[model samples]
Target: MMEMILKTKQVSEELGVNPSTIQRWVKFFNLPCQRNEHGHYLFNEKHIEELRKIKDQLSEGLAMTDVQIDIPKKEAVKTKEFTLNNEIEKRLDKLIMRIDNMERRLETKADEVVSAQLLQHRLEIDDLVKKINSLENTLLEMQEKQTFQMQDYHSDFMLEKPKPVKRSWFASLLQLFSMIKS
Candidate 1:
């Protein structure tokens, strides 16, 4: 006897919810759902049970991310209907691939964030260097102006004085003799 696989509509009606909600749960929560050859979700009794539990958790005011789920390995039904080892290997491979993809995405995001921070710091340093150069040029100009003013002040005060007259004593004696004769 084969196990009955239910469609999305049937599961939705059974759970009294919309089909889109079931699809969302399967996609976002990685609910163990298999796709048919026509690319439609094929949910077994166990998958439906899991969906019911998810609905109950949501109804109890639990956040979607906080709702943890554990998917158990598929076991042989009755007379070894399927090879247990092969199924385990396939599931393990799929899980490893998913883990690798997540690792790559995390590394890429971290690198992008670091690069953005470095670029911001580089731009800020460039602006500061420009401001420093501008201030240096202003100081040099002020110093040059001060040097020129000092040179002009010194030239005015360092000039030579004129010599005194040399005939002062002879002129004084002649004026005294003339006064006596008068």
Candidate 2:
């Protein structure tokens, strides 16, 4: 008579539980399991029967401590180590997901910062343009004032001096006769 050995998946299927759950059960409840040459767990029919009993007890709302199954000390230690390793792996996966989420958020924040800076730069450029326009208008007004002042000065300079009073002919004759008598 050959004993039938089943893999974890097969046992989980037969028991209607997940494979990981089966491993946890094997660890916690100290269900008898044989390790294959490849270091995988193999369960025999007797092991299955023991698992069924444990499952029944659990389904009946019995606490693990109250189940009253004697497990070997060495096997319990091994199971504890396995459970701890599984826990660590699960925690590491969660931490990796958190880090990924944080990186995405940081990228989003950086984009927003760049956008804000661009808007600020645009506003500064607009202000400078307005100031330049104002300065140009002032310069044009000053030039116009200077041109009007120059035209006024030119008109003043061009005014002709009053013509010298014309000499009378009588006055000229009297001056000549006086000179001849002398």
Q: Which is the leading candidate under lDDT?
A: 2
Candidate 1 Cα errors over 4 Å, as ranges: 1-83, 160-182
Model 2, runs deviating above 4 Å: 1-79, 160-182
lDDT of 2 by residue, 1-182 (tens): 99899999999999998888778778766666889999779999877877777778888998554554444665444456655665775688899999999999999999999999999999999999999999999999999999999999888878967788877999989989999999
Clashing pairs in 1: none
TM-score of every model?
A: 0.39, 0.42
Using TM-score as the measure, which candidate wins?
2
- lDDT assessment of candidate 1: 0.80
On residues 58-159, what C-alpha lDDT tens digit does candidate 1 reach at each position? 899986656656565342122222234435545888999999999999999999999999999999999999999999999999999999999888886677
Provide the lowest-lDDT 10-residue window in model 1. Answer: 73-82
Lowest-scoring 10 consecutive residues by lDDT in candidate 2?
69-78
Q: What does each candidate score in C-alpha RMSD?
A: 14.8, 11.8
Instruction: Return the number of clashes found in candidate 1.
Output: 0
